[model samples]
Target: MLLESLSPLSGMINLVLVLLSVLTSAFTAAVGVGGGVLMIMALAQVMPAAALIPVHGMVQLGSNVGRTAMTWRHVNRAMLAAFLPGVVLGALAAAWLLVRLPAGVLELSIAAFVLFTCWGPGLPKRALGRGGILIVGAVTTLLSSLVGASGPVVAAFIKQSQEGRLAKVATFSACMLLQHLSKAFVFGVAGFVFRDWLPLMLVMVAAGFVGTWLGLRLLHWLPEHRFDNLFKWALTLLALRLVWLGGQRLAGAG
Candidate 1:
């Protein structure tokens, strides 16, 4: 019963998930974003439905921590400083409310958000003050607790604030790391048992570290314009997939 609860899949499917983790992490590392969404999408196909958010959160927490550590010098300390207060407020609110999403709502909402961040008229480039950053942080953190990955939202805000690619990636990774941290804490407070899947998560995180290393190497060779185009296309495809998944689930229920 313990094994069944922890790993609903056969050994082969577990191997596939670990491989997916590596590829997804590397992809995120190279393009400076989109890996966590990809990983969760794939995980949803294999893992038990109940474990999706918490397991994904832990895997991304490890992966982003790796990316942030590798590029710590480029992180925007001022921005993170402003974001922390909002994260605290958001986590507290999420824990207190204990909001459980209806089946299709979370996926569809994430799809819409990803599309907007990828293609919609972006937020103005003006640097947000502390208060603005705080609000953004709170909103993203709150949403992330529900959906599992808020990388696109965090990326959009970080893109507006930072000028260079390295700065953007570094700071964005830092912000996500913190968001995952908040999520883990919230789940713990809410009585989600994270230890059930610790073994699989550790293996996936190790694979993600390798992927992040390879992705960083590729990041240097890829031209900026080329990377931008690839990033946009990848995000669009993922968003479409999410929309389809949500629609199918809703249709089945109706």
Candidate 2:
């Protein structure tokens, strides 16, 4: 019975999803990006009934909070201070103003936005102080609000730092937590059902804890270049897939 419950493709895939949560959480911890975003996409394919943003938001909240706890020493308070205001602004919009965007259209546009961010040549690798941080927070929060999670974008900004693994993880986790908080608040205000999601999120959180541990352990053995390249390709693939999904949704909308 226990072995039956542990299967990855069977009734226990939710459990496996939880494990994926853990692994991706650790991935974010180790590489400073890609926590719930990957898990959310995978879950979307498997759990078609789930509401994408809020469901993933709570899980992400749990994952990043855990990562931040583990890597708290490396957090960049100065950076967070600058970016937070913009995030709050975006959250308010998501909660109050943008509730009715046509589903597929919004997703496709967001997918395109992410692709542009990924392929665009103009983004700065680093920025400091209130101005830079606010811009980062605003842009990332806006994108995240629409698309559930955009760990890669946030990482693009954070990865420019010279901070090593733990620091990168800590600071990135802090930023994501704030973003997820904003999202949860917005979704709650928008009247998405939540009571049922609580139990599922709890499971995902547990999985995220273990996944993060493993990802961190793996990072210790892998060369830095290999890790970076892997993450880069991962984001690229995620963006492309989202773009296709979004486009199909757009076609359906029309």
Backbone clash count, each prediction separately: 0, 6
Query: Candidate 2's residue-wise lDDT over 73-141, tens digit each?
Result: 778878777778978987877666655567566555555655555566634545545677787787778
The candidate maximizing TM-score is 1
Which residue segments of model 2 deviate by more than 4 Å?
A: 1-13, 46-50, 99-129, 161-163, 246-254
Residues 1-254, model 1: lDDT tens digits? 43233354677777888888889889888887788887887888877777888899889999999899988999999999999999988888888886766667776887786687677786654437788789888978988887765677677666656766678778988988888899888889878887778878888889999998999899878887787777667667777777887888888777
TM-score of each: 0.85, 0.78
Query: Candidate 1: misplaced stretches above 4 Å?
Result: 1-8, 100-117, 125-127, 242-254
- Winner by lDDT: 1
